[model samples]
Target: MLNNNLTWKTSPCSHSEWSQSDLVRGSRILYSQQWTLITDSNDHKSIRTVLPPGPCVPVSGEVLSGLSGHQLLEIWDRHGLRKCLNLTALNKHGRVYDDAQFGCLSWSECENKLLYVAEKIKNTSIEKHDGESPCRKPQQDRSVYCEDWGESLTNKSVPVICVVNLQSGSISVLQGVPHDVSPGQALWAPSSQSVFLVGWYHEPFRLGLRFCSNQRLSGDNLSVSCPRLSPDGSTLFYLQGRVFGPHNQCLSLQQVHYLYLLVVFRLLCSGFPSSLIFFVFVVASSAGFYDLPDYGSWKLLTVQKDLMVVCCSSPNTPPTLRVGFLPSAGETVTWQTLQQPVMTFDFHWTVLDVTTPPEEDNTHYSGLDFGAVLVKPSRPPIEAKTPLVVFIHGGPHSQFPAEWNCTTAGLAKLGFAVLMVNYRGSTGFGQDSILSLIGQIGSQDVKDVQTAVRTALQRDIALDPNRLAVIGGSHGGFLSCHLVGQYPEFYRACAARNPVINAATLLGTSDIVDCVGIQYSYDQIPTAEALAAMLEKSPITHAAQIKAPVLLMLGGRDRRVSPHQGLELYKALKSRASPVRLLWFPEDGHSLSRVDTQADCFLNTVLWLHQHL
Candidate 1:
């Protein structure tokens, strides 16, 4: 039975793989356990779970490309649930590409073939003995250098499209794909005659692609992904955007009217459009966050014909899944509650549209409007002013969408009004806002945050300015460090997760060197003036003035912003005899997204805020 009264602590459950048997007339969605198949009962009025073929052991550990401990490509019978094919024997083809940047998992309409992206087979051949044929050798002395996509994608350097015939259980590496291009996000054509995939060309060299999207082939002017063919295979729909600039741009919707003719039509819209399997709809909003204060984020899990499954949440709410019936032509979408969380506490949220100060020089980002999502507890302390925690999102290009965030909601539950600032450079606002922050990172972003905080304080009478605190990660962490350093007396406390302390220092170490270069508007090649400009814009430049109690969260395995960045700030603050704390997660990356690390980080942040503010 579906749990309608699910609590906030209960994280939302999502399914990735969905299969429908052509022979059977029902829908079967497989969980790892292989049970819980939803079927229409009582003549379509009700739904119930039914058993499939057989039970299987959970394929454990981090399944994403770089973090995988073990991975298996298993195909089971849709009707009987009998295990049909397992491609674990094909280890020579390297690991299957599961990283979001370059991963593909698709099944042909016939269900006899499966298309996926996997790493190019590495050379395991030993030096040929005299008159002896070359054989597999685990310990080869030969050394070869390979340039990868860098950062979290260290293991996935060269990816190739592979197909498997389920009946024969034969794997075939597709030929004709360019040697220089890394093929991913592949799907089979309707007739199953051809394959469509995004081929990312790594010509000169491959930079870190995890956090940066400015990487481009020499002549290609646009980047594209997620190509899907219409049911009849006449139209091709995919997302395309300009190659350079912000890490994320507002990707425009494009369609190929005639697949063979290649006649393209760009769908124009005032807002962004989200694509489902067969449907495309505009997610319109003037505010940066999607759906606003009521809904945090609406994630499309999967689309089954007329039924669309979406996950929605907000700062005060936990993620809930909803099944919406796609309206035909003029009809409106009708949503049915699939899974909803039971709220343990009362809280409310509002979207705040803040403007840059009138007197301040707004030369670069003069017209760009940035704002924040303010979340607060329902009940206020009668005698005391409410504390405020300024939450900044990473990406510098990313925005804090109307979505449920554990940290943001947890802070509000603890009686701290959280202000999630969407600064000028954030996406969803358009290309101009994102471009505004090209040459201005620290100063412009920091000032925008400061202005937002001040504006919130001015507007909300109950907010306590003396109890101000700030928290952010990655570039957001950069701003957190800046907020305390530049305006030493502003924030009472701060928490930075994998922050960029010194851009000049990061240039030599961080994986996304292009991100650093682009932020400061410098060329790829470094110069003395570039170094000076990087240092001048860095948060560490003003570290001597930072007086707030700080909590530093450093991920040892982080490649985007090295752990050295946090240690640099830690050492500087400690040398000044300032109050500071450091929490290190050795196994985590830039996200610190591991379950254990997230729990520890959240607890420590709450404790830190309580201790300092």
Candidate 2:
């Protein structure tokens, strides 16, 4: 029998009967009253304190009154100072944490002494075990570490993992990994003490996983996420198998033909073993299968002595977190349904949490009342006085779903209260709402975010209006730039990453110009006249009006919102004598995929916010 008895409750509005704006205020009030809790169903777990809500905490401070999660591991210890890993290129070159005093030191139960990683001069060879030195097992081959280091891997075209030994001041490279796979998150499995690396590939959106011990691949390669090991290290818990995207490089016929053939071949021959011909045939025969646009599905895979949970979801149905036993043939496996219904956002999303439940209650804010989702921090909330960082998601077509957003979680850990606004023109709310943003960039959509901020402040659920920083990327970056310039008083500072500064310029330079023109029609057509009118709405034109300090970042190979967009705005702002700083990634494209580039973008973004906000 399925465990459908699991209770799922909706959020309650404290003051239901109120005006639109008033209802939004009331909703915020209600959200503040409720406390977020992370529960570990497993017994024998250590309990940590949670951080309180508010914005008084500093970016570098560790105020854990209400934070929770596995990511919070070792956060409260002596390593707290090193919590903000400066993975930026600038900091690495400067050797900011080279000294022993600034480095992290942990007493290992197995090694009996300190273990840590740190930076040193580029050419210096790391000397191992020079007596009472901070380096543990220095004589051990540094290659035993899995991380990649040195100029070769750093300058490589594709993403690679590098492990560094701070004790010996040595760096080693881990090569031969697939170039298509880009590693995003890594952690040591609790149960097996084996390092688990999770990443994605573009062609078909395949997730890769490998278990490494003593710098060696162990066990058959397993694919999973939300991986949890049994307390006794005898089992592994994870989710697997949801094919995302076909083998299409672009939305074209050639790609489709390639993918169709590949799928057929995989089904007919080398793809399946002789043990499961019947099961494979059944899956291959499913109707309307290819019709479903590559919406990914995941199955919970639990690997115990001989058992595993292989939960999966489809585009049209909720996720069935399945429980299965191993060594049995594919079709012979038994299945049981999980209680929670899984929801999928965009594939790239990293953090997910259900905030306001589906059932709606009365709420209002600024003549507009609506339901809201507050992306709570994985760590505890900051003190009341700290600034709130509102991240505007890009793809004006995308909705800020409550999922695993690394950027939001990382900022939350750094003490910023974050809210991902799913304003009008976003997805998930259905097609009508999305179409509303067709020609309305700075219209009701902008008001939605404004209303959200006002609601947050009025209900005492977030930071004061004065302590606000708007940060975003792409279209989101455009909104941030527009927000500061158009509504200068609302934001204290702005951080825009690869923003579309001028829509007029974008319309001309963009590869998808024809597509955008069809989407956002021209109002007054005199060809050049209409284009010029569109330019008036561009943030680049209003650069002078933005009083707040700005930090702009762009990629060199950015063909989407060309680097010229960022550079032109920077130039305009500088000419106006506005406080502005620009950073560029010569080796990067539209987004920062390289670990070093990602780390740099993250660190710089936070530091810039710290300085300005």
TM-score of each: 0.81, 0.44
- Per-residue error for 360 in candidate 2, Å, reads 21
lDDT of 1 at 555: 90
Supply the TM-score for candidate 2. Answer: 0.44
Against the true structure, what is every candidate's RMSD? 9.4, 18.8
Per-residue lDDT tens digits of candidate 1, residues 1-613? 1112111111222233322222242223233322233535442322343334254333322222232454455454447543344455556377787777778677777877777888777555554434211111224632445667776887677787777776776777765454566667777655665566676767655667886754553236776665766656777777777675667777787787534442122212211111112221112112112222246577665544444556677777776656544555555554555544667357778889988777654586576788899988788788999999999999989998877777887788788899999998898788878878887888888999999999999999889999999999999999999999989998899999999999888987876654443533224578898899889999999999999999999998888889999999999999999999999999888998766777788899999999988
- Candidate 1 stretches greater than 4 Å from native: 1-71, 78-81, 84-92, 126-145, 261-305, 328-331, 516-523
Write down the worst ten-residue block by lDDT for model 2.
276-285
Q: What is the lDDT for 233 in model 2? A: 37
Candidate 2 residue-wise lDDT at 142: 35
What TM-score quantifies how close candidate 1 is to the native fold?
Answer: 0.81
Candidates in order have lDDT scores of 0.70, 0.46
